[model samples]
Target: MSNEKRPYKGGHGKPGHAGKPGNGKFSQGNSNQGSGQGEGGAKRKRRRRSGSGAGVNEQNRQQSQNSQRTQNQRSQGRPQKWDDNSRGDKKRFENRGENRNDSRAESRTGRRFDGLTSVERAARRAKTEHDDTKRGGGGTSQRNKSGHERNRRSMSAREFSAAAPSARSRTADTARATVFEVLRSVAESDAYANLVLPKAIRSHRLDHRDAGFATELTYGTLRHQGTYDAILRHCVDRPLEKVGTTTLIVLRMGVHQLLNMRVPAHAALNQSVSLAREKIGAGPASFINAVLRRVSERTPDEWYELIIEDAKDDTERMALLASHPAWIVRSMRQALVAHGRPATEIEQLLEADNLAPVVNLVALPGLGSLDEAREQGAVDGELVEGSALYASGDLARLESVREGTVRAQDAGSQLVARALAAAPLDGTDTAWLDLCAGPGGKAALLGAIGVQRGASLVANEAAPHRAQLVESSMRPLPEDSYTVLTGDGRQIRETLRKNASALPGSIEPGQLFDRVMVDVPCSGLGALRRRPEARWRKSPRDIAELLPLQRQLLDAAIEATRPGGVIAYVTCSPHAAETQNIVAEVLESGAVSLLDSAAALREVALHTEGANGESVSVLAGEKDPGHTPEIKVKKGAPAVKAAENPTTAQLWPHVHGTDAMFLALLRKN
Candidate 1:
C-alpha cells in the first residue's frame, strides 16, 4: 500500500502545447504571445534623469553609455531578444541570473526566443512550463500526512499514470496492484489466479516479501470471493454483475484486506481506492470507495453473523460462515459419508481449504538429490519420498530444479506416482504411460525413475501447449527415453498405434505399457489450499462435464495396459462422481480387477522419508507382512465398509498433510 502520490500536471507541461496561442501577459517582444497588453503599454520605457548643470548632463550621458555596455555584457552570445525593457521586466531578468530558465529552454529546443515576436515567446514559455511540470516542477502534489512514504521516489511513472490522466492505460506495479490485476484477469479472462499471479508479480519486480503479500492477497480474495460478492451485492444499489470487472476486482481485494489481513482500515481503503483510481475511471473508483467504506463498517465475524442469520438450512448457514458454495458444502458432506468419516468434519474441511499449503518439491530419483535442497533451508516431506518442503524463497533458484532434476510437486502427487512405480508387477515392466500428462510434474518424476529402471515412457498431453510443458519437464532425461504425444487421451489406443511406427525405441502397435497412469482432470476441489482461485472457478456443472472425460481416460488406460500390468487411477479430488463412481463404472466392464491400492500405498509410504530423513509411516508397523491396517480415524468416525473391489486410498489435507488426492490401483485381468 505505497501511498507515493504524484503531482497532477494540469494546464502546464502538456505535450502538443508548443505552437498553441496563449494569453498575452509577459508577451514582451515575442510574437508567440497572443495580442493583449497589461497595465503598461506594450513598449519599452526610458527613465528621466535629474541633472541641472552641463557637467551633470554630460555625466548622465556617460552613465547611460556605460549602462548600455553593461547590458551588452549581460546578454552574452545567447541574448535575450525580447524588447521588454520595462522596470518589471528588468527586475525579473535580473533575478534570472545568466538567463537561467530561458537559457536552458533555448538549449533544449535549439531556438533562441530573443529574435521572436511576443506570440512566439508565449508559446515557448508555455512549452517550457509544460516540460517543468513533467520533471516535477511547479505543480501541486498530494502527500500523505501520516508516516514517511516508503518507495516515494521509486514509484514508476506508469504506476500513477492512470491517476495522472495519461494518453494510454498503464499497468499497476505495486503488490496490491498486482493482486488487482490477477483478480481482474480471473474475472475478465477466466484465467486462474494461481497461474496468472506469479507472472504479474515477476513482471512488477516485487521483492520476496512483496511477492508473498501479493500471493496471499490474491489467494485470500479468491478463496472468499463468494462471501465478498454477497456482501458487495448487499452494499451496492444494483446487482453485483452490473459492476465492471476492474471495479469488482478492486473491491474484492479491498474487502479481503479489511476482513482477513491485518491491514488497517484506512490503509486498506486508501490503497484500494488509489488502485481503483489508477486502473479504472474516477466514477467507478468513487463507487468502489463508497461501497468499501460501508463494508469496512463492520468486522468480518459480525458480517458473517449478519449474512448467515437468515440461512434456510444448516448447510446454507455453514456455506455462508465458511465462505464455500452450498453445493460444495453438501458435496463434501456426502463425500465424508461415502468415505466412512463423520459428516461433521465438513466444517473443518471447509476451513482447511482457505488456508495456504506449504510448497512441496520432489527430487526425482537418481537424477535428483536431497542434500542440496536441505542446505537451502528445505526439509524433507512428511508423507512422500524424496520430496522437500520449502516455505520461502524462489524454488527455481535451486540448481536441481533449474536442471529439471527436481520440481515443485505436491506430496500427495509424489506418493501416487511412487505407488505405481512401487506396485509389484509380473512380466516385462519397461513401458509406462501418463495418459493425461500436462504441465507434467508427475511425468518428470516417473521419467527419472524410468531412466533408473532402464525403461521408456510416453507422456501424452491433449493440448499442444501442455505437451510443450511436458517436453520441458522431461528434458533431464535422454530424448529417446520419453516421448510427448499431443492428442486426446481418450484416443490413446489409436494415437499410440499411429505413433508406434515412427516413435523411437520398442514402442509399436499391440504393445501395452507395463504401467499406465490416468490422472484425469476433475473439479480440483482437493487441491484448493494450493490453488485458492479454484474454489471460485469450479461448479457442479464442472463435475458433470468432467465425469465423461474421467471415465474415458480410465477406460483408455485399461485398454493400453498389459494384462498383468498395473494402472493407477488418480485425481486431485475426492468427489465420488470422479473417483469411486468412475472407477466402479470401468470395473463393471469386467476387463480389469482392482488391486489392494491401500496396501500398495502402505508399501510405498514405508520408503517415504519425513522431514527428518526417517522412514515416514502412516502408523507404526502399518506395512507388516500380510496385514493391511485401516487409516487412523477418530473414535466416532464412521467405519468404511470394505467394498468387494480392492480398497482405494483418499488422502486428506487435514489428515494426510497432502492434497485430497484419490488413488485406485487396478490390474488388467
Candidate 2:
C-alpha cells in the first residue's frame, strides 16, 4: 500500500522559485524534488477518463492534484528575487535539475508507477480515510485502507515510493512472513545473523545508520526475550505460549521498544498499535495498544522498579529487574565470589550482560600499529593498548578492515594472546599451537606474529567446519611457516613428539611452542550483547557442563607448549570456573606457572579516536586491575616449583568498552 499515491499540501519546492517560469512549485507525488517538466496536460486529461473510479474517486484525485497546484501557486507567490541568495539558489536548483533527469531514468516494478500518480493519489486518500476511522472512536477495523490496503496492493510491482518525513518509511516497515521466514531459515538453518542482516539491509537499500539500528533492535530484542515474554504475559490476555508466534514476535518487538529503548511513549504505542492492527487481527489491536500504552506510561527505570517490586527474593530481584534468568543471576553471583570479587559487584556483572560490545581491533604488528592509528584520532584503551586497532568507521565495513590489515577482535582477547605471544619464552625458534582455533581469529594474528618472528605455528581445530576460518586467516602466508591441522590438540602433541627426531629444525633447543593460545569454547555469557540469545540459552549449570571441556582444552594447550612456554587461556565469559579456576586447577598439577599477562600486553600500543575525520589511539585494558599487573609464574626446570595462582584479566562492560572477556596467560616452568 506504500505505493498508493498520497497527497501533500504546499509541499513542492517554490518556483524561478518556478521551474517552467509559470506555476512553479515542485510536483507532488514520489517524483524527485522538482517542478513539473513535461506539458502533457491533454494526454493526462484523455487518460483521466479511463481511470477506474466513480466521480468521487475522480474528485478525490482532482482535489489532490488541485491541492498540489495550489501549493505550487502559493510557493510561486513568493518574490522571485531575494537579493544575492537568488543567484546561488538558481545555480543549486539547476544542478539539482540535472541530477534528477539522470536519476529518474531507471525505474522498475513499484518504482515505475510514478506515471500513475493520479490513481495512486486517490487510493491513498481512501486509505487515509480508512486509517482515520480505525484510529479515532471508530475502534479497530480490519478494513484500514492505508496500511492493509497499501500492503495488500503492494503484492504487485509499481514504480512508486511512499515519501515519508519520518525516520522509518513504508518500505522499511514492510512486513511479510517471508522476511522472518528467510531470516529464521538463516538463523536456524545457517546460524547467519551477521551474514543475513547485512545482505537484507543492503538489498533493501537501507542507509548505514538505519542498518545499525535494525541490527540492534533485532539482536537486542532477541536477547532480552526471556524478560520480554515475562512482562508480555502480564499484559496479554492469554499465556504468551498460547498466543500465535507472529503475535508473540510483534508483541516482543513492541515490548522491546516500550521497555528497553528511549522511543517516545505515544509514538511507540500508537505506531505499534497501528502495526498490531495491520499485523494481527483487529481483535488484538486495541488490546495491544492498551497494554503497550500501560507499559509505556512507565519509563525503563520505572519498569525496573516495577519488576523489582514484584520480586519476592534476591534471585527474583536480579532476574526480574535485570531481565536475566534467576538461575543465571545466581550462577554469576557464585562466579563473582569465586573470583574474590564482592557481592555488591553483582549489579555490575548483570548490567554487563545488557550493554553492547564495542568494536575491538588489532593492527597487523609490523605494517601498522594501534598507536599510529590512534595518533590519527582513534582513542586509547588501558591494556593491550599498544597493538590496539581503533575501529575505522563502521567496524563492519571500514576499508582497512576489508583489506584484512586489521580486524575486529576483543581487546581482552588481544591482551591475552599478545601477552603470550610476546612473553619471553627464551627460545629462538618455537612451535606454537592455537588449540581450538576454529575459523582462526586469534590464530590469524598469532600466525602473522609467528611468521614475522621466526616461529612455526600449528593451528588445530577439532571442528572441521571451522577449519576454513583457519585456512582463510593464514591465506598467502608461506605454507611452511604454519600448519592447519584438523585433529585433537592433545593427540597432535603426541604425534609431534613421536616425530620430533624425524623433523628437522622442529626439535629446537626448547621445542614445543614458546606460547600457545587456547581460545576455548563456552556459553559465551560475557558476550550477551552480541549473541542476544546467549544469556537466555545459558543454564545455571552451564559452568559445570562446560568445566570439563574447558579443562581439557587448557590441558591440551598447556601440554602443547614447550617447557617454560606460555599458554594464553581465553574466553568471552568472566566466570571464574571457566577462567581463573581453569588456570588454577592446571597450576595445581605443578606442571606450569602463571605469567603477568597484563605487563606482557602493555608491550603493544593502542588507538582510541573516533573513526571518521581525525582518527587517533588511547590507552587500553588499564581499567581492569588484573590486566595492568602481571600474574605470578613458576621459573625453574620444568615442574621445578609449585605454580602460582594466575592473573585473570576481566574487562568491564563500560570501562573496557568491549565484551566482558577473560584472559590469563600461564607459563610452563
Candidate 3:
C-alpha cells in the first residue's frame, strides 16, 4: 500500500470499495486490501468526519471535476466561458457544492452569476467595448456602461441652452434676492430694515448701484406693504395670511417695482416669479405669477383709486392712499392738532413718511469734519452744521464713515444733541449723561462735543448688547471722554453712584451732571420714513405702555441734573402722550422748569452760517407760525402761556425734511 494521496477509483456499493475486475470494476480482494490501507483509509476517514449521506460524496466529486477543468482551460491561455444556452453549464455554475452557505450566489439584480450579477456582467462588457471603440478597435457603436447609446453630435449654444431650461430660468437676480431676504428677516424676526439691510448688502457684496436698488426695493416694499396687501387681497384667491410667507414677500416686492419703482411691469413680474420659484417651489411660483399678473393689469393710480374706494371715511381713504394704517392716520391728525400744527397737514405729513429719507451724515464735532464727505459728492446739510446729505451711494464707502467720525444721523437728531450741549447751564458744565443711549448716535455727538468743551459723558443703557454698541460708537472719540454703563436708565443715579471709582474725570459720588440727554424710548412714530416697518409694528397700546418708562426716565434725568443744569427730554416721536404729556408731568414736580427748546434749536441751527454767509431758519416756526402750542398742564399744575415763545419744539418731516423729533428742554430748578 502507498502513503501518497491518490484519486478515488470507481466503485460499486460502498465508499472506497471496488467491484469485480471482470465486471469493469476492481477485484473484491483488492478493494478490501485498499480500504484498510493508505489512500483508501484517508477517504474512509473523511467520509466518517463529514457524517453526510452519499449525495454529499457525489457533490464533492463533481466539484473536483469542475476545478480540474477550469485549471486546464486557464493553462491554455483562456478562461472557461459561460454558456447561457447550456442547462448543464448553468446548473454547474449555480451549485457551488462547497457545503458552505455562499452569499455571492444571491445576486442583487435577482439574476445569479459566478460572482457578479447578469447586469454587472453586461455593464463590464459594455465598458470594455467602449474602451475598445475609443482605441479604434473593430467594435460596435459607443455605449455607456449602462448600455445607453451616447449622443456624439455637437450641439449649438442655442440648442444646448434650450435643452436645459431649469438652469437658465430658476436663478434669481442678486438685488431681488437681497431684498427678499431682508423682508423675510423683518417679518420673521421683527427686525428693523435699517439694521438688517446694511449687513445684507455687505454679505451679498452688491455694488453701489445694486446696493441703491436693493435699498429702494426693501424700503419701498415695506413702506407700502399695507397698500400692497390691500391690492393682494383682491388678486389672491385665498386670504393674504393664508398665502405662504415667501410667496407673499415676493409678491410685495413685485408690486412695489411695478407701482412705485422705475422697473418695467414685465421685468418685475418675471423677476418676482423667478425669485419665488428659486426660494420657494414651482407650485408657489405659479401662484405668484398668476397673482402678480392680475395686479399688473391695472395702472398704479387706477389701483390706488380702486383701493381708496373701499375706504369708509376720509381717515381710511388717507390710510389706504398713504399706505399707513387707519389708526396711525388718525393719530397723526390728532398729533398735528395737539402739537399746534393744523390738522390739514396730516396729508402732507403722511406723504412725507412715505418718501424715503436721504442719508444724513454728521461729522462728530472737533474729532471729525465733513470736508472728506463733501469731497466724495456729499452736499452741505440744510438743517445742522457739520452735517452732509449723502445721496450718491452706500455711505460706508467713505473713509470718514468707516472711521466712525462721520456718522449717518438724522438732522433732527443732530439738532437735539446740539441743543442739549448749547443749553445755558449756571454751574460747572463739565459732566453729561445720556440716560437711554443704547444705539449711541446722539451719545456720540454729545460725547464729541463734550470732549471739545471740557466735559465728560456717561452713556447708560439697559440692554447689555446695546451698551456694547454705545461703546463702539464712542470708540472713535477719546476713551476718557465717555463712560459706557449697562444699567436701567431709571436707576442711573444708583448705577453712577456704584461705579463712582470707575467714572470719567470729575464725576464723583452724588455729583450731578450739568446736562442730561434723556432720549427716552417712545413709539418711534416720527421716524416712519427711516424705519417704515415700524409704522405697522406700532400701536396705541405700545404708546401707552411706553409712557410709564418715558416718565420714569425723565424723572431720573431731572434727579441726575444739578441745580440750574438743563436736561433735553427727547423722543423720536411727536405723539402727545410720549412728548408733551411726559414733559408736563415732569415739569409738575417743580424739580425742573421748562426752557425754550425752540430757542435752543434755533440757536444751534443758526450757529452755522449758510452758503450765503447768513443764518437760515430751519425751525418749524419759520414755516408754521403757530408751530408752538400751549403746554397741556394738569388742572392744578402751573400753566405755560401760549403767548410766551414756544418752549418745546417738534420737527416735522413735511416742514423740515427730518424725522418728526420732539424736544423739550428742562432746567433743574
Candidate 4:
C-alpha cells in the first residue's frame, strides 16, 4: 500500500517542507517581522496608498486612533463597535455576541423596533389571543386587569401599535417590512443578513413563527438575488442600477415569495405592492405590481429552466439555476478539485448553501451539561460530544447559555478545538494558545477542556474589543487556567520567545505551548448557509488577499508550538486557495510535519460520547443517510482504505452536516 491513499471522501494532506523555524515571517531567513498590526505590511501599505496622503491622511489616521480609544473605553466590559473595514470582521463581532447591548447590564425594553411590519404585529396578536383562550376562566374585568399587568411588564398594545411605521398598518406585514430593512442595509452597507435579522427579531419582539418567516424571506431573497435579477432584467425596461435600491429590494422579496415560499402569488403580489406604495409612492408600487405579476406567471422550476435555457454552457446554466454567481461556482469547482474531491460536487455544494443550516450548540465541558440542554428541547448532536442541535426557543432562556455555560457553536468548530486539545502530546501538555481568538467560541471550548486537563490557555485576538469578548466567554472557566491578550497573533511567537510577560501565567516566559489553534481569518465561504449575506459579499480578491496572512499565521503557529506538541490549522472555509493551498505552501516551506488529521478527528469522534459516557458514533461519509448527495464517485473506489495517512480533513455541509471546516494538524519538528 502507498501513502497516496485518501482518508475520507474530502480529506488529504502532504508532508511539510523541511526547514528550521526562524522569526514567524513567511520569508525563509534573516527575517525582521513587521510591527503588531493585524494584517501584513504589504496589505496595509496597499490600503494606505489607496487613501489620500500627507496631512489629510495623517489627520484621518489620528481621528481613527482616537475613535478606537473611545470604543475600547466604552467596550471595556462589553463587545466593541463592529469593524467597518471587513464583513468577516463584522461577523466575528456578531458571533462573539459583542454586537448586542450588554446583556447582564442593559434592559431589552426601550430599544424599539420602529419599523414594525403588519405581519409581525398580527403574530403577536394571535399569540396573545391564544394565551387568552388558554385562560378562559377569567372574567372580562379580570382579563382586562391581567392585560394591564402584562402591558406594564412590556410595551403596551397602544405603544406597540404607535411604534410601527404608520404606512405598515396590515397585521401580516411585519416580516416583509423587516426583510426590506435588512435587505436595504445589506445593499447599502454590506451588513450581514444573519447578524441584522436576529437583532431585528429581538427589537421587534417577533415570535418564533414570525422570526422564521422573516429569516426565510431575508435569506431566500439574498441567496436567489442573482436568478431573480436575471428574471428582472427581461421584465424591467431600465437597468437595475437606475431603479432605487429600496424598490429593487421590495421586488426581490415579492419575487422570492412568489417563486420559492409557500405564500400565494396573489398575497405575495398584493402585500409587495402595498409595501411599495407605503414606502416608495404609488408609481413604483405599480411598477412592482406589474413586474411581480409577470414573475408569478410561471412556477419557480419553469422560471429557472427558462432563464438558463439560453446559457451557452453547463456552468453558466448551473450558476443561474442554483442562484450563485458564476465566479463563485467556478471558484467552488476549483476548490473541490484542489481538495481531492470530485469537482462534480459543486452543484450539491451550491445547493447546500441555499438551504438553511441546523443550529448547533456546545455544552462547555465541566461548565455546562448537554443532558440539561436536551431536556430543554435540544437534541443530541450525533457528530461531536457536548454538542446539540436545537431550533426553537430563545437561547437566552436556557439557564446554561444565560449563565455563561454552554454557547451556540458549530459542531465543526467544536471538533477542531477538541482535536487541538486532544492531539497526543509528549511530556508537559499544560499550556495552549488560541492565536486568533475573536469572539472566542473555540477559546471558550478550549478553556473548558483546559480546566479538565489542568492546563492553561492563552487566547490572543488582535482587536481590543474582540479580546474583551474572549475574556467574557472564558469568564466561566477558572481564571488562572486562561489569559486573554489583545495583540497580533503574527507577533505571538516572537513576543513570547523574547519576553513571557505578553501572555503572563498561561505560559512561562520563553516557553512554547503544547497545543496551538490557528483559526486563521479567511473569506468564510464554508459558512455561507449560516451567514447568507456573506456569499454575495466575498470576492476572488478576498481569497487572494487572505492567502498571505493565512500563511504567515500558520507559520507563526508552527513557530509557537513545542517540538513534540501539535498545532491545528483551522479555517471556516472550503475554498482551496484559503485552505489546502495555504497548508501546502507552509508544508513546502519545511517548518513542520503533518499529522494524520483525519485519524485525529476520528479519535475525537470515537472518544466523544454522550452524558452517560457511552461512545458516540459519528458518521462522516454522508450527512443524511436517506438523502446522501449524488456524488460522481469513480469506479474501483475503496470503501475504507488503510495504511495511507491523510494529514488534513475538509468537513462539508452536504457531507458532514457542519460548516465546510478545514483542519490540518501539524507538529513542529
| C-alpha TM-scores of all predictions | 0.71, 0.64, 0.73, 0.69
The local distance difference test score of each candidate is 0.74, 0.60, 0.80, 0.73
Considering lDDT, which of the candidate structures 3 and 4 is the better prediction for this target? Answer: 3
What's the distance in Å from true for residue 646, model 2? 5.2
- In terms of TM-score, the best-performing candidate is 3
Tens-digit lDDT string for candidate 1 (1-669): 011111122221112121223432222222223333332323211111232434544554554555575578677755544443444445644766556767886898787647688899888887676466455553344344454332112223232322234312433448887887787778768888767886887788889999889988988888888888877877886677656666778888889999999899998887877787777644456567889999999988788878877889999988877778898899888877666567888888888888888888888788878777889888877666787888766676688888988788888888889889988899998899999999899999888888889888899999999999999999988888888898899998888788876454856666889999889988998998877767767889989998888887888888889888899999999887887777776665566667777767776763546789886566224222112223333344333434343677777776677888888888887
TM-score of 3: 0.73
Better of 1 and 4 by lDDT: 1
How should the candidates be ordered by lDDT, best one leading? Answer: 3, 1, 4, 2
lDDT by residue (1-669, candidate 2, tens digit) is 122222232322432122332433434343223434344633543454565524634555554555465467669895344345245545755687765655674433334334447778778876676675445423323344244521211111221212221212222153322233333543346454554665666566656555565666666667677677767666655466555555555567777877776766776666665555554444355556777766666666766665567678988887876677887777677766665556677787677767765556677665445544565456655545434545333444455555566666777667666666777666554577788888777887787787788777777787787887778766645667777777765576665555454332443433566677888888787776666666655675776888888888788777666676777888888776687767766766667766665545445535456558543334333353353222333454343453343355666564466676676777666
Q: What CA RMSD would candidate 2 show?
A: 21.8
TM-score for candidate 2: 0.64
Give the per-residue lDDT of model 3 (tens digit) for 1-669: 334223345432224534432244453332234333456567765674475635655655665566567679889999676554444644645564531224444534443445676699878886676565445352234465678664322222211212212423578899999998999999888999999999999999999899999999999999999999999998975578666676788999999999888999889988988887677654466667889999989999899888888689999999988989888899888888877778999999999999989999999988788888888889998878898898887777888888999999999999999989998777698898999998989999999998888899999999999999898899998887788998998888889888887789767777888999999898899999999999989888998898888888888888888877888988999888888777777765556677778888887884445689976565534543124444444566544433246477888999989999998888777
Which one wins by TM-score: 1 or 2? 1
Best by lDDT: 3
Q: What are the per-residue Cα lDDT tens digits for candidate 4 across 1-669?
A: 121111121111112222233333232221123234334545644654575634544554554565566478687877554445544534644555543445422455444343457798787876676455335312122323335421111212211221223334433377777887788889888887776887887878878898889988998898888899989987776688767777788889998898889998889998998887666654456568888888888877788777987998988998898887788889888877766678888888999988987788898888888676788788988788778898875677688887779899888888888888877777888888899999899999998898897888888899998889898999898777888877778998664554466454646877888899999998898888888778778888888888889988888888888877789999988787887777666665555666777766766763446579876446433331111111232344433221145457778887777898888887776
Query: What would you estimate as the lDDT of candidate 3?
Result: 0.80
Q: Where is the poorest 10-residue window by lDDT in model 3?
A: 155-164
